[model samples]
Target: MRARFVSATPSEPAPPPRDGRQSAAALLVARGTRRLLRRLDFASVTELPLLSGRRADIVALSAGAELLIVEVKSSVADYRADHKWRDYRAHCDQLYFAVPASMPLDIMPQDAGLIVADAYGAAILREAPRHKVAPATRRAVVTRFAQAAAHRLHALSDPDAAGAEAF
Candidate 1:
């Protein structure tokens, strides 16, 4: 499914609750991964689109052909609740997990990469999405990244953004 953002004055009408913690976590992973990727000379973006039926949290592209998807979890419950994260297999070339700063460094999938991070900082302890990711999916990632990047860049350029600096 596709998701869009909407904004309205609170006095006009309270729209809907966008309690997209799942989507938020996905974006967090993307944010954290982008930080990690930059160290490796890569550009990263969050909320990469999917091919009709799938969605990815974070999408990162190295200067090389490298690509990655990161899934961030705020709680253990969140992690256990998602057992089929493997299904993301069809979409990303790499699968990774981003955990809260307080989470233990262990217990993550040994084969899969791990990124310890919070809202501000991220460290790449490991890098493993899956063994393989489709080429088309990689393109979808790039397209989504481009779109998200443009939106953020535009917002940052706006004078009304108020102290918001580009990351």
Candidate 2:
């Protein structure tokens, strides 16, 4: 599927568009990525298939000859603890983690792909890395993920809707 996401830096307080304002880190990475991708000639799909999982966040896929998955992270703990992030590698031929530009990329695994982004653009810090995932408990995890994703998608598609009415 084509990912359809774009990141733009915020200029003024209460910017013209809500989407232009990204979290501090995302802003950095988005900016960083944009500058880097200038040399490449390819399109990117934004907010692509956001899988259902324990730590589901926005994912963007590269629109090109090859399949690429980019996972965006906003928190340090989430950076450390996103379980199904490992599973993402299974579905896609290429997988990567995207984060804010200023944050140190030192701690990230040397073999795992990385994207450093800021509000203006993004840059690929690392690429062509290896990821390890064990298959033992993935079935159960995927099942739970499917259910949660279905519910979350429903909520997003219908913002005015509410769950079973809190009483």
Q: Against the true structure, whose TM-score is highest?
A: 1
lDDT of 2 at 123: 65
**lDDT per residue as tens, model 2, 117-145:** 76666667678464433343344433443
In model 2, what is the error at residue 138, expressed in angstroms? 20
Evaluate candidate 1 by giving its C-alpha RMSD to the native, one decimal.
9.5
RMSD of each: 9.5, 9.6
Which sections of candidate 1 miss by over 4 Å? 1-33, 129-132, 155-167
Residue 162's lDDT in candidate 1: 47
Residue 148 lDDT in model 2?
A: 45
What TM-score, computed on C-alpha atoms, does each candidate reach? Answer: 0.65, 0.50
lDDT of residue 40 for candidate 2: 57
